[model samples]
Target: MRITVGKWFQGGSPWVWLNAGAVAISLVMVVGLLALIAVRGLGHFWPSAIVAADYRVPGQESRQVLGQLADSETVSGERLRGAGLPLDPSLDVVERSLIKVGNRDVTGSDFAWVVEPWLQDAHYPENVMAVERREWGNFYGYLKAVREADKTVATGDQAWEVFQQRIARALAIHDQIYQIEKHDIGSINARLERLRLKERGLELKGNATPAVLAGIQAERAALDAEYKVLEQQLGKLYVAFNRDSAVAETADGQEVILSMGKVVRAYQPNAMGLVDKLAFYGDKLWEFVSDDPREANTEGGIFPAIFGTVMMVILMSIIVTPFGVIAAVYLREYAGQGFMTRSIRIAVNNLAGVPSIVYGVFGLGFFVYFLGGQMDQLFFPAALPAPTFGTPGLMWAAITLALLTLPVVIVATEEGLSRIPRSVREGSLALGATKAETLWRVVLPMASPAMMTGLILAVARAAGEVAPLMLVGVVKLAPSLPLDGNYPFLHLDQKFMHLGFHIYDVGFQSPNVEAARPLVYATALLLVIVIAVLNLSAVAIRNSLREKYKTLEV
Candidate 1:
């Protein structure tokens, strides 16, 4: 089957095959990574259990019958049975008795054995049993029931009535407590305000009369005493809220049932149960999306890292875009061809290749220590002892990333400026446009797509960066947001958390690694999505601009 072929295709084909192989390998690597991430991240949301039950059925049966029923005497049709009197045609006798089934460890009991009359028609008959033999099913349900029953026996309407009455009484007590505390605080504040006013009056009169001064001093002392009492009372209320007795109420006006201890115990089993495990992870994922910045880690949600990451990226973009574009414009269009310009171009390219960690160190030294120190010495002598600019903060992090990604923007923008046809510039100059005017209107609009592309790359790089930000501004945990109620509220000097740092911290540095693994994967997925969205948006803008200017022939 040999056939003649062209000389070019007949020999030295190994290089072509090698190039194809390399491309295939790269595609496999990228696709494999995406597949792995998608599987692990999405698997967390899938249901992992067969059955779930809370064991708090409102209409639970109080009685349970065990053992088989006794046989009944049967009637014969006009015939006598051996060793007995003649059987009647219509007479019949049955034996029945009530019995109690003792509680047992039915972990291995069959589904049929644990079935009660009410549970026979359950959707998942195997899962709805009161006592599960298998450890795989929702064991936590049974445990919760056991714990809840120990705390309270009433069920259904009876339980609801008891709960309502208790809540009402607790509310009444809380209202009384709040009113008393408010009145005491108000009185103390009023007295303090009056004392301050009197002192001002004395100053205005230019007469520090002994009686007036004494009156002011006495009022101040009284206000302090009252405030102390109010604080003490408030402390007591806080203690009460923490204690079980605060929510406890007597069913018969004689015996109080304390629920705080019981409720906490009951919650433990439910938390350990399979259904609760699913719910817990679900909530964790939800928290990653919906959490507000005000919540702490202990409160089940927080979004400070998300907010800080966005703010830092925006600040970096603002600082880098203009500087990079201008530098690119100067290098590509204005700068004459010379050894000096060529050398500078090489240096700028090399800067982009430098390790980000090194940039972080440079930023810490130059921006934080040198520039910040100079500013502090020149402008803030009264606040001299405290360091402001020298501290690691949001501003420093942004500036550091801006520098790190500057070369990328510069290279991209320069390529864009180079792409515009030479005739366009000649025509602008022919029309009496100056160099600045050409750059501003004609050159910039044409080069915008390239600039946007550079900005997109810079943003993508800066957003995922963890190591540099860690050294410069990112904190493991930030107590307050960078923007707050303080004077000149947007405090760039304040340290902030980032999602990338959070991923690193929770994955490697967490106290409970096993418990935090899912959270780590979820956070990593979120970071990827955020970066992808930012890049996609920039790409869209670039495309839109390209389409708008498509009709303008080069």
Candidate 2:
């Protein structure tokens, strides 16, 4: 029998095809976006050959320009002329390249766009060095001499090798200084502060005795002594760190001296072979994930943000899962399915659609001010005026996200619970199991996969949220991680960084727009990868649960 087009319409085949096409289009768009992000982000670390050229433009003197070619585009000649550039009226289009000039201290700008037609004698110089600095961005120049205490130690043919050796030594010293300052001395300072608070508490309680006071003073003295010793060690390390410097001639023939202590890494991209470039690229990629931000968060790694994001998501899962499951169980198994129950379900569904910033406002007002303030007054009176839990921190951020995602978990779990056969429950109750036992041992195991599905959904939403976190706990830069080697291993009261906010800060709030653009893409890609890993892990567990209960459902 021939199938007519009108019959196909009645049979819903067209709708099926339409839905499949829509799904295919969505998947393609998501994949294409990921590919674009990866290309723009990962390509930033690869070493590009530095180009030396003389930029000649109409009505302006030609000057030496040195930097990496960042991007290129074709624009109308009229646009170029409107920007005060004297372009030929006969030409319809003009080609230009955006160059990363790097010497921000000298030029006051990190990037510039120049017309390609006026670029003369463009070439790569093998001796040209790109110095990644701890501040003020990168410096591009030619190696001149390596200095030790204002005296030239290596010059001419051997300066590069000597400079590299000294830089490596300086970096080692810097690491030691970091450890001493941020960890050892930091621990002592924290302990000393605790002792001070303890002493004050004793005094406030009218319990200040000579014996207790003596003990506190003794501990404080010991910590102070330790701090003094670390301070002396840091002093010596600083002296050694500042011992070496390098002189280089810029593209414009200006000689500049860069301190070895301020340099992060220096390399000649033009002189590198393919293997060398690959190794360099790998190192930079690792640094982006492991190092701390420098130069107003435009340079270096974002490990803190990554750590905070994962920690917050894990905490939110821990908080939301049990509460959501309990609520779901009560609604599905115990509650009378009447008007009140339906009303609550409707309210929950509506909550899922509430603006996220409203949650942030609620978290700040109730959680931070009311609940946390009560906690501080009840438990930590010695730290009065200086709020502990009374301010925004990690704990509040986690709780706020959990509250935001509770509706998702409840809806998903209820659906899972609804799917179980009534016969299954009757059989359990008939077999000498109580109602609670059947619900706990039989029903819950079969529905475990659904609980995990809800958790996965919650994590997917919580990880990328920036607004609520910004109000509750997230900061531009957290000097210390919420989880650290302190006495309380996990300080729930401490503020922390987040990858989503990092992307926002770097992308929109940065002063150096051109330098921050690539970092924004890289951080965004990392956030996506983090979310994917969390979802995949939950999915794996859900699949395992589903397999384990496959026969039980039957």
Candidate 3:
């Protein structure tokens, strides 16, 4: 039996199969892309053996090089020769490997591409040290000796054991220093600034009388005394932190002295067993997520970015939901079904199609320049020269995103409201319920699932948006989170970090492209996971709402 194409289309089987094929292809592509990103990004944290090899290219000197093999690729000789490199005419293809030669101060670059044909006698040495740093990225070399100032503490075979011990002590001290500076002293500094602002405000109000001044002075004195104690402790810590230095020799045999506090952690990747390597990898991954970024944000963790992203999304959701729901209820329940209402609905639908960057521009001009400026002029007169709300910060970012996604919420809610049977509303009215009561009690409950759906879509769109955030509140590095332990714990006026902006900054604005590429993928993967989590939470709520209202709707 020959099945004609028209007959198959008429039977709807062709359309069903066609849709299934499209969905399958989409899933495969999305999964494949995510897998690729995961492999490239997550694999960067894993410990790889550092290869020490003598590399020579034709007439070049045979100098030894040491680095982790970063990547490999095949290149046609024609392409190589086009770039002014001499290659054999007979060579059709040549394999090359990129080695992450990580002594940046010594080599001036973290990576170097070496032709595979020119490398010889490659081996992994157990004694080679890979030192993760607080400043210079990573240092890969052989530890020559352990020293304190000019005095050599340990050398020869004893250097490794002694180096390990002193490094552990140095790291412990570094942690203490970090805690005091960032948390303890940081809190003090914040309080001191608040006190200064308070004094300024009092003086402006003509209330800085002698007694008030005296009381403020007394408080300042107490804070100063406390600061001095913290300062002395910090001074002692710095002395301890910088006292221990290790002498390491690069593959080129030049000795480099690295201060102990500068080193984050050091290990011999080449000598680690599978279990040890896995442990190290786990530790590094945790640090990446939990630690604050250092070294121009190419290294370390992204906790600040994560926190800011989630906070902004939540704030946006809070601001948008009520406004959207109210508008939708009025339009669907109370508004006359006339030309004017239809026009307003069309305008709202059109808003969903507006470019995101346009919203960013509108936010910057209206919210930041106009509204924020007025706020600073009115409420923050003492802080005139330095703008308070008259700057891009968390609140404005949230508000801007709320406005951008309002249309989506309104449309979803209206559709949900329309889906509720007129009979239900009539029944409520017939039961002597007021119109407001029907909307509040009966109408909204059925439409709650649709509101959740809108929120999920809104979050998915807003979470990944970078352009608007860049203009409003997103920054490469935020010194403090929007919410903190300070009074008015949720500091809505503070500028914030964001994962989407971090991806953009790392991928494009970073000084080192090759080094930042993996970070980009990792950050991208993190963003996808965050959006998924948010959507799943909304979905769970939506499912529960649907279940609860199922009988009511029927």
After the best TM-score superposition of candidate 1, give how far the Cα of residue 44 lies from its true spot, in angstroms: 4.0
The order by descending lDDT is 2, 3, 1
The window of 10 residues in a row where model 3 has the poorest summed lDDT is 1-10
lDDT of 3 by residue, 186-210 (tens): 8888888877888888889999899
Runs in model 2 deviating more than 4 A are 1-3
Q: Over the stretch 34-81, how does candidate 1's per-residue lDDT look in tens digits?
A: 777767655544333322212221245332222111112333334332
By TM-score, the best candidate is 2
Model 2, residue 123: C-alpha shift (Å) = 0.3
RMSD of 3: 1.4
Q: Give lDDT: candidate 3, residue 97.
A: 95
| Model 2 local distance difference test score | 0.94
Ranked by TM-score from best down, the candidates are 2, 3, 1
Candidate No. with top lDDT: 2
Candidate 1 segments whose C-alpha is farther than 4 A from its true place: 1-28, 45-284, 292-299, 552-554
Clashes of 1: 1
Please give the distance, in angstroms, between residue 6's alpha carbon in candidate 2 and its true position after superposition. Answer: 1.4
lDDT of 2 at 82: 92
Per-prediction TM-score to the true structure, in the order listed: 0.62, 0.98, 0.97
